[model samples]
Target: MGAECCNKDCLKPSVIGYGVVAWLSSGAALGVGIWMLVEKSTYSALLASLFYPVTIYILIAAGTFGFIFAVFGCAGAMTDSRCMLALFWITSFVVFAALGSTGFLALYYHDNVLRKDINIRQAINESETNGLKDVINMLQAEVSDKLTFCLLMLSFLS
Candidate 1:
C-alpha cells in the first residue's frame, strides 16, 4: 500500500525492504545450519537453542523451509491469490509486530505460559554451568594444594 516506487522499470513491488529481508533470512538460515553442522558441540547447541524460536519464525516465512508464505504474499500482491495473500499478510503483520514492538510479548509473555517454562529452563541451564565450574574450581584447588605439599616435602627432604 505504501509503495515507495511505482516505476515500470522497478522490478520490486511495494517495498525493497521485503526482498532484502527475505535474502537476509535465507543467509541467516544457511549460516546457522552450517554452524550447527560444523561446530557440533554442547555450547553450540545451547547457543543455537536460545534462538530456536526465531529460527522457526524464519522457517515459517521462506527459504529452506519452503517459500509458501512468501510466495503467497507475492501472489497476493500481484492479485493472483487473495486468500493465501491474506493469510500471509496476517502472519506478516504478526511477525512485523513481534519484531517492532511487543509482538514478542504477544507471541510470548513473561507473565504468561512461557514465563514459568523459560524460568525453569534457564535455571536448569545455569545450575548445570555452575556445577561444572564448581567441579573445575575444586579440582584446581586440590591441584594447588598438592603442588604446595609436594614443594614443602621436597624442601624438607633436601
Candidate 2:
C-alpha cells in the first residue's frame, strides 16, 4: 500500500507538469491563431490562393480544442479521475492531428504554391481595398527599416 501510494504520488506530479506544459503551448497556439485571424486582411490579400485562410482556420480550431483538452488534463491529474484523463487523452490526440495536418499543409504550400503564386509587388499594385494598401505599405516600411539597419551594420563592419 505504501509503495503504491509513492508511485501514484510520483505519477501525479509528472502528469500535472505535463498538463502545465500543454497549457502554455496551447495558449501560445491560441494567441497566434487569433492574431492570424485578426490580421487576415494583410495575409489573405498577399496570397493568391485560399491556402492561407484554410490553414488559419485549422490552426484556430486546433488551438481552441487543445486549450480545452489541456484544462481537462490538469483537472484529471489533480483529481485522479480516470474518465477525465481518458477524455483529455482522446481530445489531445485530435488536436495533435489537426496541428500536424496544418504543419504539413504549410510545408507543401511553401514548397509548391507560395513561390509560384505569391507576388508581393503585384499584390501591392493590385490592392483594391484601402486596408490592404495600408497593410502593404506598413510591411514595406518595416522591410525598408530593416534593410537600412543592415546597411548601416555593413558600413560599420567595412
- Mark the 10 consecutive residues where model 2 has the least summed lDDT: 114-123
For model 1, how does the per-residue alpha-carbon lDDT over 1-158 read when each residue is reduced to its tens digit? 44645563353365334634654665565465555445444333233344445544443443343234555566655654659656766765655544444235335543554665565567666775664345445657988999999999999999
Ten contiguous residues with the weakest lDDT in model 1: 59-68
Q: How many clashes show up per model?
A: 0, 0
Clashing pairs in 2: none
RMSD of each: 14.3, 5.9
List, residue by residue over 15-102, the lDDT tens digit for candidate 2: 8888888778888888898998897766565655667778878888888888888888989999999998998888888888989999
Winning model by lDDT: 2
* Candidate 2 lDDT for residue 28: 84
For model 1, which pairs clash?
none
Angstrom error at residue 66, model 1:
8.4
| Model 2 alpha-carbon miss at residue 92, Å | 0.9
